[model samples]
Target: MTGSRSSSRRALLGAGAVLIPVAAVAVPVVQRAAERSAFLALCAAWHEAKDTHEQFYADNVRTFEDEQRVAGEIDRLDNVALRLEREIAGAPARTCAEMHAKAKVAERMGERASEDIAHSLVADILREGPGA
Candidate 1:
């Protein structure tokens, strides 16, 4: 009876030993899967925002600026935003300031760069009479 008890104890210990290695390997795989899920979630959210929302801003053009030049400035702001994304290469956990570093860059780009993209997007509305 004592021998049977000893054999069962060894079997339990053997099972635990095998499970230890499996758990060790599984832990990192699970962590990486979680990180991947987080990254994809952020990316998906960013895309959803772009698809579902429109940016709005006011642009007061000086007497001298042409429409073509205004459009080009908006394009340049977009390029700056794109460059910032590449530079930041970051996760969603980044601070709001960090996330908007691009817009800040656009604001710095020129007097109207910050508003150009939104302005160009709705030029017709601005040109048309008010909604009231």
Candidate 2:
């Protein structure tokens, strides 16, 4: 019984030793995948917000004040998009491929939230009365 217990313990330790390296390798890959997904989602959301802002400008922005406000929002979105682009460029090739594969899905999911953000901004602008 003592020999059997010792052999079982040794087998368990051996298995753990093999698993430790695998887990170590897997953790970074999983973390990178999560980070890539988050980055892509942010980019998709930014695109939606920028598109909504442009549409609002085209359809509803009549006054100079409203135009200026919308333009500023568009510029802000552009700057963030540029930053995201830079990050994407720096990402690993595999990460980029995975992100590209998933981007459209993320964009579709983000559209509603982006519209909400745009609506909130428009409401604030309207409440502030154009020039205020």
Candidate 3:
């Protein structure tokens, strides 16, 4: 009877060892899925902003001052992109909600830049020619 009990214990331990690796694999899969979803959402928002900004510039409505302003804004946006990329690459990562919040902030910044450029262009057109 004692020998039978020892055999049963060993079987249970062996089963537990097998489960550890399965659990490990499952955990990373779940984490990767969440990260991919968050990344897709973020990319969607960024693309929308990019498309809108492109449309805004399609009017050929910029002035000399507007060009300078846009140049500065583009520099700033580039920096933001680099920083966000780094943050995304390094973990402990944030949830989808947190990523959306960050994306919203970026969207707002882009919107503000667009507005500023439009206003500058309109003002320049009203004030004088391209030389001014």
In order of appearance, the predictions have TM-scores of: 0.43, 0.52, 0.34
Q: Cα miss at 17, model 3 (Å)?
A: 7.1
Q: What is the lDDT of residue 63 in candidate 1?
A: 44
Alpha carbon lDDT of residue 14, candidate 3? 100
Which one is best on lDDT?
2
lDDT of 1 by residue, 26-124 (tens): 999998678656644544444443333224113534445544556665565556555443432433322233324333333444564434433432342
lDDT of 2 at 66: 75
CA lDDT of 5 in candidate 1?
Answer: 100
lDDT of 3 by residue, 64-96 (tens): 776565776655556554454444333222444
lDDT sort, best first? 2, 3, 1
- List model 2 lDDT by residue over 3-69, tens digit each: 9999999999999999999999999999987876776666566566667656766885788887786
The residue ranges of model 3 lying beyond 4 angstroms of the native Cα positions read: 1-22, 55-61, 78-132
Give residue 8's lDDT in candidate 3 (0 to 100): 100
Best prediction by TM-score: 2
- What would you estimate as the lDDT of candidate 2? 0.59
